[model samples]
Target: MKLKKIGASILAMAMATSMLAGCGEAQTEAPAEAQSTEATETPAAETSAATEEASATTEAKNIEATEITFWHAMNGNLETVLTEITDEFNNSNEYGIKVTLVNQGGYSDLQTKLQASAAADALPDVAQAYNNWLTPYLDKVVHLDDFVANDFDNWDDVVEAYRDECSEFGFVHAVPYNKSTYVLFYNKTMFDELGIEVPKTWADVETAAKTVYDAKGISFIGFDDLAGVVEASLHQNGVDYVDATGALFNNDKGLETFTYLSNLYNNEYARLVGEDGYFSNVLSNQQIASYVGSSAGVSYIKAEGWELGVAPLPGNVNKAANMAGTNIVMFAQDSNKQLAAWEYLKYITSTEAMTKWAVGTGYLPIRQSSYETDEYKAYMAENVCAAACYEQAKDFFFSPTFDASNDIRNTVPGVVEQLVFDKADAQTWLDTLTEQINAQY
Candidate 1:
């Protein structure tokens, strides 16, 4: 059962005041309500130390290492890079543990397998996880505190925000594996034909979109209008999804972002594509001058045979983009397996593995150490068009999906769809929609 706060308090009170409140009582009195808060209140430092000691004790057992499963979603060219790294680990590591990498379909399929594994006590030692799924798995997963303390190279120097997100459960659930951000893919031929300069700001994007539209009578760009895109826009504008109390995306800036997208839809500057390769079809036909999509789309964009220009996602207030894809999570596996899994995690996050991964696939590397290496720098220089995505790495934030984030994802698109159809005023529709979303969450 889910751990309800009220039930926890009552449980604590029963332990603390059991002597005072008799044995026969079903609904006991709240006798001075001084429940033990210790388990939940120990500082993060103490918790880290305790977890380290626990890991050390497990290591001390000297149990024979066994084979462990490692579930992931590295399809297409990306799959080759992951296998290369895994093979290196399997062949060279002195540790007796063996990891069998399993491809478990896409992100949604992985989540389904994870939940079933949790129920059957069959979870792999390490599995791929999305950020939204990380929260609920906190208690059931192994934190990386011990792993980092023992084997991490310059691990402490990771950016504070990125580290904190990974370590919020008092242990690092997963190391930041791959990083990605949004970029505007423009038609270089079209831009040159119209004499339009590449845009670096929101005003520039609007002007260019309008210019291309007026000149060619085609929508300059298309956005998915998915919550990921909306969250990116809002975050770039310095808006957050939560505040001191709880959820806070239903705010003024958020409403304004919604309104702005609606205005674009109404004016024909940006249009949303229907499912079933709608955006891809538009791109192939050259009906859209630009498309803002995931950096992971690099390979697919190249295959479409259209010359592409990749530019940093434009921002009105600040530079930011919502991170997409998944993270690597080592679940509550055997202690020996956990350490071995961590060894693999650390090895893959190193500069060598990162370069191979990026070159094979389109994923951006996660470590600052990556950028310092000549190989990564050379790769970036070789593909200068992707520099905007590389530079925006520092500005990556969690996408809008929280525990109940699906609510926002499902609802926000409908609100925009309504506004695009001109069924309601943009601001009015968003305000009401945000309230409904908050309530659902």
Candidate 2:
């Protein structure tokens, strides 16, 4: 999917304007209380009949379900799979609730619309959101902790890391919907011809790069996005880019990551797709040996002449992959609508639904039980690349959650560009960028 980048300043301005407007309230006077009457003054049979009638009325009201709106950004095959599952939910449920799906283009467009809706108090019943992007609107979203504890039956089956990813400040604000991680996509033909082993660490990657260059006279690897490389590198080295206070990527670990990438780029061993164009073209043409990218991107990879191999990304200090994808959050609305939304959310994440999702799309299933199913195992046997994604799920980590997260993501490419093209010192550029990012806080 094409991820659209939005300016953090614009998002902040919209949120701020909405918050100020949301604070206004109207006051009303209370009516005077009437004198209390004794219950014994009423006839016993009349009271019983009145109580039965009220109970029946309440039951009828409870049974009358509401139609809720769900906003999403899925398209193509992803959209197809979601539509099928949604239809199943609508048809199988006993409740009178019905879900209407709305596609707001891609994730970026969805976020843009969501912000505007917040400003106008016109948000949908449920929407797709990233953890950091949704943090600012926590007040407008329903915390799912109480619902999970009381209603959801599959809470314990969810992966621990994913569960934590959906929570913030001790409350569950969202649930994992479509989740993915990074993996290495290599050309097996090139590896066998050059007698190179699959890379398991940064050192191994460097060695393989040198081997491929010496043998084929082309770039060894191509990065679809430099910012992703930077993020993964820092994570592998146990460095935090952002936290509660501010940017943390100006330190030793960050410098090491930038310097390593800079050396690779400076030496012509690796090329960023921003400069070299698409990885699919480069890999198929044998211009580069391999590239590390999102597991969900596996569908875009096309190898014409050789077998494609997918594996976990090489680690330096530790094994880590940046978790990529959005979560499903319910908007704060009427109780009936909220309950209906929760039912839909829970249904999609169920074992059967997630199994179908994982098999239909390359997205990782949120529930551990989804992996143990025979259907999923059969699917994995056919698609090895997707299996690698499931293997790396245990080590997946999320980016920082803050109001300025989009700003931080936007700033990453500049730092990488300076390091790769301008030949700027890693520490110096990182320090400057860190200060700029911290200023947003």
Candidate 3:
């Protein structure tokens, strides 16, 4: 899929008008309290005595037949797979609970819907979301502590990176479903032809890029000079983007980070690829031998018939740090609705579901159990290149969690773009941008 770039102008306007506080909590009130909280502890309440008598609904039957509304951002084949999971959940048990699935388009589109729904107090019981978007909605969403304690898996069972981003408010409003990381993708065929081994560090990657450019008439990578991607590279180099007080983009590490990238553009080993056509085209043709991007890009790379290999993003100090994939959250607080949402969340994130989601799309499986499952392991065994992505998960970063002042984030890309196209001074650019971003922090 072609990832759309929000225009610089629009992002600038968004930064101006948008809250620095990340996502704003949906301007909505919680549902009225239940008169009898006891009803929450009992699934028996879903069935009436007369109705039970009429149908002779057994415990097994009720367990096999429950239904709930689920909203997601999947489309095409990805959408079909999610629907299949919902169908399986509805069929596997006697509980009458059925999941009514809704496709809400992409993440940004889903965010807009959630914002509107939250404002109107009509959020779907469960909805898909990213970590940044969830921060602002925390006040309105139902905390899953009580549910997790009383019912299924608890927070400690999840990955530490996910737990760190979500453990606030004493409850997890979201669950890590399709976790992902960033890695460097290189053309294995090109590497062999160049007689160069795969790059393991930023220095090695940069040297290889220059070699490829010198030997062949091709650029080694297509860099869009984007913000989020650059930040991932910076953080991987031991740069703490935010301290207890706020943004830290102007520090020695941050400047050193962009200075390295500026050197790439200065040397002409990397060039900005436009958002439209020819971006993926050049990469697939091996005109660019390496690209640093999300692990989720694996599916597209494979489908295009490119021989691919991956490595933990080349780091100056550590391994790699990247933003993980989005999280799923709930905004409606009706006890019954939250319970139903929890069931769907649990059902969708089971080892089975995680495996299916990962294979169907290039999303990483969030559950440890899923990684051990036969189906997932088989896929992994076949795709040795994909291992780099999973291996780098240890160093991944969640974006909004560290973007408190939102200054570095809003400025870094512009600085990098200028350095790339305008031959801007790295020290001056870094100093000015740092001052602006740190002021907000």
Candidate 4:
């Protein structure tokens, strides 16, 4: 809720007058893997131009103009950007395909309404969902492999990590839309005054925290989400959170991550977010020197007098971060509406449109080409806060998708809270939590 609340406030203030509206491996070879999964059938050598033209003509005739509804959880400035993008798509197309935008409050609200609609056989044409959230509704959703094979020409341009997340069993079930990753936001003023360099590794973080606390008597770092920190630490150490068999967070690497964070908190070098629940205010007031949070949180961080700096999260065994955000999934519908929805989906994810989306909102562009575009480069040049996120985009991973994903994700905070506040034994708590998660599987 703190994430949503802070983002909403900053987005609303800027809008005032205008709108109302893979856990797998290290993923080093993701691009090649993604390309291999795409359908690659091509016309034969003897195929003529006439044959191609006729096939195109026949396919065009099969698709009919229709209105398709899109349900999303974006609000405030995000909704405003979505409206503009959707309107542009609607206006540019020659087909009379109209996309209706529906805001379903937040992600949780959207999930509830989506489930209810599915039970009633009244799902929308398309909706936004996290990869894990699609597990229960796979039967009702359209796999995009055929669509990508025939229609989408820029399939290779999508970021590899995102492409992998949208795929399951060598098939793409969704398209990455709003995507982001974690970054370290720190106070440059404090770092410079205290003779502490920007942290580039876990050891650097410890040294900086100790230096700051010794000199100024303030907690050096505060994590908005303890689970997120734990996950990132595990990934940096080359460990998975879960797999086909069971939870892997109780392994030796997991214990090391827990011990690291516990030591930080116990030694007064770091703290979890407090009751006020806004790190921007905490940082601006000089209560803490830095925090690890989403890249989309740039608008929420207000370091008035001090120069705010953003960097990739410090690495331990390796440099890594957690990928966050949702994908656009089309629900099963009549051919006409499905075609219309696919057209809208392709249009929105196009390089030109996604450039606008990424620049307008703080979210990263899913397309690799979007990053090379002049517009995105200009925006990045002006707004340096998001540069590190984009730079570290390739070095990120997603949690494995499973039936108990939401439940498993929800269990983390309680386990982490016990470690941070109650001084619970790390190995015992993790072992118990691992058992509970394995039971769900």
lDDT of 3 by residue, 266-309 (tens): 78777776553323445666668877655554444431554666
RMSD of 2: 16.1
Error of 1 at 396 (Å): 2.3
lDDT of each: 0.59, 0.67, 0.56, 0.68
Which residue runs does candidate 2 get wrong by more than 4 Å?
A: 1-63, 275-278
Best by lDDT: 4
What's the TM-score of every candidate structure?
A: 0.81, 0.83, 0.78, 0.84
**What is residue 350's positional error in candidate 4, in angstroms?**
0.9
Candidate 2 clashing pairs, residues 3+ apart or interchain: none
Q: Cα lDDT of model 2 overall? A: 0.67
Clash total of candidate 1: 0
Residue lDDT tens for model 4, 74-177: 87678898999999988988788889999898777888899889789789989987655655665677657767777885787786667766775345668888
- Candidate 1 versus truth, CA RMSD in Å, comes to 15.5
lDDT (tens digit, per residue) of candidate 1 on 197-308? 8877777878988898898888877864355566666666667653213345566877777676766667788877765243545665688888776666544443255456
On the 0 to 100 scale, the lDDT of residue 228 in model 1 is 54
Instruction: Give the candidates in order of TM-score, highest first.
Output: 4, 2, 1, 3
Cα lDDT for residue 206, candidate 4: 91
